[model samples]
Target: MSDQQENKVVISLDDLLAQAQLLKKQIDDLSAARAELLDSVASIEAAKASIQELKTQQEMLVSSDKKGYLMFKINNQPPQKVLVYLGLSYYVEVDMDTALKILDERENELKEASTGLDKKLAESKAAYDQIVDILNQIQAQAQQKGE
Candidate 1:
C-alpha cells in the first residue's frame, strides 16, 4: 500500500511539472504581448506630438528612408486632414482634431490591454510558484524517506 501511494505521488508530481512548463510559456507570451502593447502606445503618443508640432511649425526635416542617411523637409501646411492607421493595414482619413481624438482612444485601449496582461501574468506567476513549492516539499520528503 505504501509503494502504491508513492507511485501515485510521483505521477502527480510529473503532472505538476508539465503544468509548470505550460504556465511558464503562458507567462512569457503574456509578457511579450504587454510589451508590444506598450510599444504601440508609445508610437501613438509620438504621432500625436508630431501632429501638434506640425500645427505650429511651417516645415520639419524628415528622413525618406529607415536609416535617415538622406533627409528632406515635410513642409507642413497645417494639414486640415491626416491619415490614421486603424490596424491590419487599414487607414482612415480624418481632420486634425478627429485624428488626435482617435489616437487618444487607441492609446487608451492599448494601455488597458497591457493592464489586463499584467494581471494575467501575476496570476500565472503565483500559480507557477505554488507548483514549485509543492515540488520542493515533495522532494524534501523523498530525501528524508531515503535517509
Candidate 2:
C-alpha cells in the first residue's frame, strides 16, 4: 500500500482502540452502579420481610392477650407504638395496620426500581460485549496485516 494509505489505516485502528477503551470504562461504571442498586434492592426486600414478621407478631399478641397487654420491649422499655421509617432519617409513630400498609407500598416501589435497574444492567452488558467483539476483530485484522 502507498505510504499515505498505510498511515490512514494505522490512524483508523488507533481511533477504534481509543473508542473501545472509552466504552469499556463506561460499561465498568454502569456495572458498578448496577451492583450498588442490587444491594439496595436486597436491603429493601429484607426490610419488607422484617415488617411483615412484626405485623404477624403483633396480630398474635393481640389475639392471645386477655389483660390488654402484649409482651414486647423497645429501648429496654415496653413498646408504645410502631415506628415506621419515612426515609431521610425520618420516622412516624403508627399503629400496626398503618405500618403494614406503608411497608407494602414501599415494597412495591422497591420492586419496580429493581426491575428498572436490572434492565439497564442488561443493556450495558450487551453493549460491553459488542465492543469487546469489535475489538477482537480489529486485533485479528492487525495480526493478519503483520503476517
Candidate 3:
C-alpha cells in the first residue's frame, strides 16, 4: 500500500481502539449500576417480607393471646406493641394500625423505586447493545482492511 493508505489504516485502527476502550468503560459502569439496582431490589423485597410477617403477627396478637419466639429465637414474647424504624438508628413504638400504615407507605415507595430502576436497567442494556454492535462493525472493518 501507498504510505498515505498505510497511514489511514493505522489512524483508523487507533481510532477504533480508542472507541472500544471508551465503550468498554461505559459497559462496566452500566454493569455496576445494574448490579446495584439488583441489590436494592433484593433488599426491598426482603423488607417487604419482614413487614408481611409483622402484619401476620399483629393479626394474631389481636385475635388471641399467644407467644412466639422473637427473631426466631431471641426470646418467646407476646406481641403487644411494634417497634417501627424512624430512620437514622431511631425507632418509635407504635400501635399495630399505625405501624401497618407506615409499612404500607414504605412498600408503595419501594415499588415505585423498583419500577424506576427497572426502566433504567432496560435503557442501559439497550445502550450497551448498540455500542457492542458498533464495536463489532469496527472489528469487521479492521479485519477486512487487514486481509
Best by lDDT: 1
Report the backbone clash tally of model 1: 0
Q: Write the per-residue lDDT of candidate 1 for residues 88-147, one digit (tens) a residue.
A: 999999988899999999999999888899999999999999999988999999999999
Q: Candidate 3 — which residues are off by over 4 angstroms?
A: 1-77
TM-score of each: 0.83, 0.62, 0.57
The lDDT of each candidate is: 0.89, 0.67, 0.62
How far does residue 20 in candidate 2 sit from its true spot (Å)?
3.8
Backbone clashes in each candidate structure, one number apiece?
0, 0, 0
Runs in model 2 lying further than 4 Å from the true structure: 1-22, 55-80
Ordered list by lDDT, greatest first: 1, 2, 3
TM-score of 3: 0.57
* Per-residue lDDT of model 2, residues 3-115, tens digit only: 87767634366676677677677767766776776676675566556556664454322322535566533233333467888899999998766776887787677667767
Overall local distance difference test of candidate 3: 0.62
lDDT of 1: 0.89
State the lDDT of candidate 3 residue by residue for 1-147, as single tens digits: 598776763436567567657656765775676576566556546545655666555332222222333323323343557787766899889776677677667656656766775676577567657756867888899899999
